[model samples]
Target chain A: MNARKRLQFGVAVAALMLAGAAGAAPVKVGMITTLSGGGAGLGIDTRDGFMLALKQAGDAASEVELLVEDDQQKPDIAVQIADKMIQSDQVDLLTGIVWSNLAMAVVPAATAQGKFYLSTNAAPSALAGAGCDPKYFAVSYQNDNMHEAAGAYAKKAGIGKVFIMAPNYPAGQDSLTGFKRFYDGEITNEVYTQVGQTDYAAEIAQIRNSGADAVFFFLPGGMGIAFMKQYAESGVDIPLIGPAFSFSQDILPAAGDAALGVMNGANWSKDLDNPANATFVEGFETEYGRLPSLYAAQGYDTANLLLSAMSKADITDADAFRAALAEADFDSVRGKFSFGPNQHPIQDFYIREVVKEGDVLTNKIVEPVLTDHADAYAADCKM
Target chain B: MLLVAEQALNGLQYGMMLFLMAAGLTLVFGVMGLINLAHGSLYMVGAFACAWIAAATGWFWLGLLASLIAAAAAGALIEILVIRRLYSRDHLDQVLATFALILVFSEGTRWLFGSFPLYLSLPPALTGAVTLPGGLQYPLFRLVIILVGGAVAVGLWLMITRTRLGIRIRAGEADREMIAALGVDISRLYTIVFALGAALAGLAGALVGSIQSVQVGMGEPVLILAFVTVVIGGIGSIKGALIGALLVGMTDTLGKALLPGVLARFMDASSANTIGASLASMLIYILMAVVLILRPQGLFGARA
Candidate 1:
C-alpha cells in the first residue's frame, strides 16, 4: 500500500508491456488436414514434411508457431477450422488440406477474406482458371497437370490403343480429359466406376475383353491400391499408367509388388537429383524413417515458399507478400519450379517408374514427360 | 462367353466375401437384436491384426489364425464391457454406442499402425493361377477364396442344423424370455454368437485384405454393402444372406460390364457410358428396393 511499492509495480508493468510490444510473437499458421481417416497417410505426410521444412529453416521456424488440426477430409469441418483460424488464432497464413474437395471448400473462402492460403497438395481447376485469386497460391500443380504427363508418356510410348478408367467424380473427369488431351491413340473405352470403389474386377474384365494395348487409370488412395492389386493378379499385363498419387511412396509399399513396374507422372519424386530435393529426401527419410511422397514434397516446397515470402515482405502487407511469393526465390525441391499467372505451379512433370531400390519399393525418374509445363486452365484466369 | 464367365466368377468371389461378413452381422442382429454398427470396426481390427502379425511372423496362415482369434476375442470383450448393456437398450442407443466404438477402434488402430495401408500378400502355395477348362486362367488365391467360402457355407449350414448351439440360437430367436427361463445362459449365448459372427467377419477381412488395401475405414464401405446383403437376404436368415449377397455381387459386376456396351447400342457411347456407369452403381440398391417392395420380410426371412 506504500507509495514506493506502488511506484515499483507501475514501473514493472510498463517494462513488461514494452517488452511485449518490442519482441513480436512468432508467425502463427493454421493447418487443417485429414489426419485420422483413410486419407490420413496423405495428410500426415504433408504435415510432417511441412514441419520438417520449418524445423530446418532454423531461425525462420523459431519465429513461426503452427496450430495443426485434423479436418478428417470433411469440408464442413475444414470451414469451421478456417473460421476458427481467422477469428480466434488470427493466423497470418493458412495451409495443409490434402483433398481437392477440401481445398475447394477452404481456399476460395479463406483467400476471399484476405488471408493468404498456400496450398500444399490439391490445385483443383476451379481455382486455377476463372476463379483464381491473387491471395491464393498453389505450391502444387493443377489436378490435371500430372495426368497430362501420363498421357504424354503414353503417346510417346506409341501405344496404339488406350483404355481409360477413373472414378466417377470431378477429379476423375479431369483425369480422363487431361489424358485424352495429350494422348494420340485409338480410344478403346472410357469407364467411370463409382468413387471409392474397391472392386475393379468387373472393370478388369472389360479391359481384358476390350483388347486395349495400354490402360490409364485415375483411382487415388485405396482405390488405386485395390485396382492395381486386382489388375496385377488378373494376368492382364498391358502397361498400367496412373498419376503419381496412385504410385506414391507412401502407398507403394502397400500396393506391394503389384505396383512395381507401374508408370506414373509426377512434379516431384524422391530420387530427383537436385540439391534441394536431395536435402529434403535425405532429411525427410532420416527424420520420418520413410521416403517422402509427392504430397510431402509439395508441403515442403509450400513451407519454403511461405518462409521466403515472409522474409522478403512484411506479412501484414498483402500485395507485397503475394508479390514476394510470386518471386519464388526459394529453391524448390522440384527443379525449375515457378508460379504461373494463375498462381498454380509451373513445373516439369517426370515419368517415374516404380522400381525396387534394394528391398524397398520407390519411384525413380525415368524421363521428362513435360518440361516446364503450365496447367491448361492458366489462360482462363482473368487475374 | 469368356467375358461373361469371367465376370460371373468375379461376382461369385465378391458375393462370397460379403456372405462371410453378412452371416456374422445377421446372426448378431437376429439373435441379440442388436444392430452393431461397429461390425466394420471388428473387420478393420481383423485386417490390422492379420497384416501386423503376417508382417512380423512372415507367415500368412499364422496371421489368418491370429486375425480370427483377435477379432473374436475383441468381440467377446466388447460384448462383455459394452454390448451387453446395449442389448437391453433400443436400436438407437445401440447404434450410438456402436458408432462410438467405430471412432475408438479406428483412432486406436491408427495410433497403433499409423495411417499407411498394409499389404498382405497371398501365400506361396496359393500364388499364381490355375488354367480352368478352356484355358480361363484365374488367380489361384481367388479360387481358394471361393473354395474356402463354399466350405464355410457348408460348415455353417451343418452347425446351424446339427448342433445344440444352433438349436439354442433358433429357439432364442423364437423367444428370448422362454430360452432364458429354460436355463439357457443367455448372456454366455449372446457372447458366443457375437464372437462367432466377429470371427466370420474377421475371416472375410483376412481373405479379402490381400486383394484390397488393408487400412483404416476399409470396413465401412464393405460393411454398408454387407448390411444391404443382410437386409435383402432377410436380416436373420443365413441362406437369405447368401442369396442376397450373390444377387448384389452378380448385379453389381455384370451391370458394370454389360450395361455400358448394351446402352451404347441405344445412344452415343459417351453419354450412354456415363449413364450406364451410374446406373450400374445403383443397380444393387434398385435390386434391394424391388425385393423390399415385393417381400417386406425378405427372400428367406421367416414370417414374423
Candidate 2:
C-alpha cells in the first residue's frame, strides 16, 4: 500500500508543477527602437516609458519578459532586428520603432508573419489604409492626425493665407495633405525642403515675403530643432504653428526660447488633466528625471494595453488575444483612447502652447482642436 | 527681389561654413595624400566639446575656444596614433582605417555624452536679426560667420604667401619625399597640418552648432557637402575650395528657393513643390558634374 501511494503522489506533484510553469510563463515582447545617433532621444524615451509601466505594474507584470534592441534609426537595421526578433528570439509581440520609414520596412513583414505589433510612435498612413493588418495596432494617432488638427485649428482661427512647409518624404506629403483637408484657406506657398535639412533661412525669407498670416511646418527630430532656432533668429514674427513633434519635451530644451509661444497640435501633453495622465507625467519625471514626451506616453500606453490584454486572454490563443487588445481596456494617459476601424487610435487632438514651466520648457493644452479624430484612410482598410 | 537678395546672403553664409570644412580636407589631402573619412568625427568632437563647455561655464566664447583646442588635440592624437601608420598604406587601407575610426569615435562619444542632443545657444549679442537694404532682416550671427570666413581666407592667403611654415606645407604638397630629404621633420609637419585642418573643421562645427542640434553624426551631412566642395574645387586648392563652396552653396540655396516658384508657373503648386524640391536637392551634384565635364582637372587643379 505504501509503495503504490508514494509513486502516485510523486507523479501528481510533478504534473501540477509542469502545468503551473506553462501557465505562468511570461509573454515575450521585443522592442526595436533607435537608441543611438541623432534620433536616440525618442527611442530612449520609448524604452524608458515602456519599462516604467512594467515597473509600476510590479507583481502584476511578473508574467511579461521584455527584450530591447537599438535599430540605430536605419530601415535596413530595423528590418534585420525584426527578422532576428521573430525568427530567433521568438517574441510574442514587437514594438518601439520611432520613425515611419523604419516602421514601414519592419511592421508589414512582422505582422504578416503572425506576430502582433503595437506601434509606440510611427503611424504611417500606408499601414492605416489598404496595408492594415489585424495583427498590428497603432497605440499612437495616425501620422496625419496632429497635422490635421493644426489645419483644423487654423481654419477655426479664420487664418486667410497660410504658408506650409515639410520635408520631401511620404509622411511629409501626408502632413500637408492633412492640413489642406481641414483648412479651406488660401495657401500662400507650399514648400517641401530636403529631408534632414538644417538650414531654413531660404524658407524663412520666403515666409517673410509670402504675405502669409501664419506659418505651418512639419520637421521632426533634429531637423525641427535646427529649423526652429534659425527661424527664431531670422526674426520672422509670423505666428508659427506645427505638429507637436517639433515642440515635444525632447526637442524643447535643445530649441530653448526659440520654441516659446509656438502653438502645436498634439493628442497628449504633460499638463493633461486626468488621473492617469497626472500619474504618468509625475511617475515618468520621478523615474527618469525628465519630462515625458508624447512618444513616452504612447509607449506607456502600449505596454499597459498589452498588460490588459494579457490579463484578459492567454497569449497562445491568437484570436482571443487580438480581441482583447482591440478592447483596449487599459487607462491610457491620453484620455479616452480607443481604436478606429483600422486599429489606429481614434482620439481627440489639442492645440498645445510651448511655455516655460519654471526653468524647463514644456507644453500645455490650450484647447481642443479635433474631437474624436479618425484617419481619412480608415475606410480603405478591409479589416 | 528682396527674397532673392536674402537667399543670396543665406547662400553666402552657407558657403562660408562649407569653405571652413573643405579647406581642412583639401589641405590634408594635398599635403598628406591620405583619405581621412574621420575628419567629420573631429568636427563632431568640436561641437560636443563646445556644447559641453558652454553648458558648464555659461560662456559661449569660452566654449568656442574649447572647441578649437579639443578638436586640434584630438586631431594631433589621431595623427600620431592612427593616421601616421596609414600614410605609407594604400588609399583603400586609409579609407578602411578612417571609416573604422568613425565607428569607434561615434560609440566613444555616445558613451561619454549619452545619446540625446546637447544645446548650444548663441550669445545675446548675436541673437537678433539686422535690417538689410530693401527691408530684409538677416541674422546677425550669420553675418558674423561670413565675416569670420572672409577673415580666415585672407589670413590663410597671407600665411601661404609669407610664412616659412606655409612654404613647408606647399613644398610637402609638391613632393613629400623632397621635403623629407631637406630635413623638414616631415612627421611633425604632417601632424601640425592635420591639427590645423581639424581646428578649422572644429571652428566650423562650433559656429554651426549654435544653429543646429549638437548631436552625434551631425557632421556626416556637412561632410558629404565638404567632399563635394573638394571635388569641385580640385582636391588640393584652397582658393578652389572657396569658389567651389560658394558655387555649390548658391546653387543649392537658390535652387531650393526658386525652383518651386518656377515650376508653379506651369504646374499645380503641390506637384510643383514636390517635383521642384526633388530636383533642387540634385542641383549641386548636377553643377559638380557640369564643372567636371568642362574642366577635367577641376577649376583650379594642376594638370597631371
For DockQ, the strongest prediction is 2
Model 1 TM-score (B-chain only): 0.96
The numbered model that scores best in lDDT is 2
DockQ of 1: 0.51
Off by over 4 Å in 2: A1-25, B264-275
Clashing pairs in 2: none
All models, DockQ values? Answer: 0.51, 0.60
lDDT of 2 by residue, B5-43 (tens): 999998999999999999999999888988889989989
lDDT of 2 by residue, A205-323 (tens): 99989999999998887778888888878888888899998788888887778788989999998988899899898999999889999889999999999999999998889899999
DockQ for model 2? 0.60
Retained native contacts per candidate, as fractions? 0.54, 0.73
Q: Mind giving the per-residue lDDT tens digits that candidate 1 earns over B155-186?
A: 88898889999999898777999999999999
User: What tens-digit string does per-residue lDDT give for candidate 1 at A243-298?
Assistant: 99889876787677877898899898887889999999999989999889988899
**Candidate 1 CAPRI-style tier:** medium
